[model samples]
Target: MELSQNKRVADMNYFELIAWLGIGSSHPGGFPATKQNLAVLQILPDEYVLDAGCGSGLTACYLAKTIGCKVMGIDINSQMIEKARTRAEKEGVSHLVEFNIANVYDLPFPDNKFDIVIGESITVFLDKVKVYREFFRVLKPEGRIADLEMALLKELPVNLRHQMEDCFGAGTNPLSFEEWHNCLAEAGFQDVEIKNPQALKDNGNIVMNELKKDWVLIKDLTNKIKRQPTLLPRLQKNAGFMKRNRSYFGFGLIYGRKPTPVKLGFKDWVRQVIFRKKTNSSK
Candidate 1:
């Protein structure tokens, strides 16, 4: 199924391509960054963890194996869910990690079931406020949330933002670091922290290193692109733009906690009403 109608290239299945290329940890800082952020979660062995938008199940498998926690990995793409299931079996963690095809905006689980809800490179493609609210709804009280998302180092010009949206396809909204903090806070999360604020350019070489490790797949793709010449120049153009504007793109690992609901005062209620209006206007 098509991931989005806004995706420019009809033939390109982004998630499938990533899985086929065997790029296990395709996020900003890869598995090492994942480990770093997850460390602060303090997940116990008996915990139930929700891996929202869990692509390929790599991180979920790691959590199951290391922490021995029960994890449920959900992705909207059925192909990704299949791959995740296969990956879990291969990693001998299927017993601990389960894969499901579901939407993030409406999670299948009941309220207050999970001890932790975590996602890597996932939230940028979603309705952040809606998804975060869903996460908050399903999380146990004081449950931890760990999310790594793409962020804009600084605001971009209109043309540049359009260029990025075209290159990355639809659902490419990225918030600034402060915006992210405010978003989490507004979503009922407390003690929100943006950690390890490294520029995307700083990790260029690391991504290159991953590309080198998957050179064989790259070679195969190069040949396939040769057969379909239409795809090559578009890919090249996007790559070139990314290289040119690397400094503007960055990612952040954010952590927050689910706090007990407090009655809002008149001022707080008015601020929330205004914030919701502004959010709708931005959309």
Candidate 2:
């Protein structure tokens, strides 16, 4: 899926703009935060991992290459899936990683298929509990979900909130850390907690830091900017918003695990039957 040359950045949605630019890490705190969360996940090589809303396959390919895990990366955007497949091939992790164009709301996989599901900056733009419910459905018993997302440090003023929606998208709704935890819990995730919480810092430095780490974004950035003159201003607009309102935002890993189903032994099952019979008689 090619971006139309005549299309203006202002006319494009936030996802479209990032896909056009091929930004590998367009989340809060960028790749550094991803790495920080990855360290805590301690994924095993044999684990079957799902990278939900994977952009450009940076994190998925890295997981396959570094941890030797088998990863399935899915994004609703065809352009992102294309880029991710290319990245997997280029990084020689094609055998370990796969990319597909699929919606997170309706994952194609069967229930209890994945050992871990990782998402970066994707849930903020959607219904948090609804998205987490989908994540919970596909995860194996006791499977883990590590979603790195922006958190509201404090209550956002109405004016700043409007500016944020303009910069990101109208649906961009970041929750407080507690709210994030609740969303996971509501989705039936046990041990719900926010890990590695930190306040937003200088946007410029974060961009530079991520650029230095992400060669894929750097390699094609010049050509993209040259093709779309509005790109710089669009980037500046979003960055300026974050830079000005840094205090109201932070990011963390919204971590949780699906509960394992309990099994009953024969003795326990018989006792349960007798108890149920007595309760029915009493009633």
C-alpha lDDT of all candidate models, in order:
0.76, 0.90
Among these predicted structures, which one has the highest lDDT?
2
lDDT of 1 by residue, 181-274 (tens): 8888888999899977777764443433454554323555655455556555654555666678878878878778998778899999999999
lDDT of 2 by residue, 15-44 (tens): 888787666797888877788899999999
lDDT (Cα, 0-100) at 271 in candidate 2: 100
lDDT of 1 at 94: 81
lDDT score, candidate 2: 0.90
- Where is model 1 more than 4 Å wrong at Cα? 2-10, 13-24, 202-237, 261-283
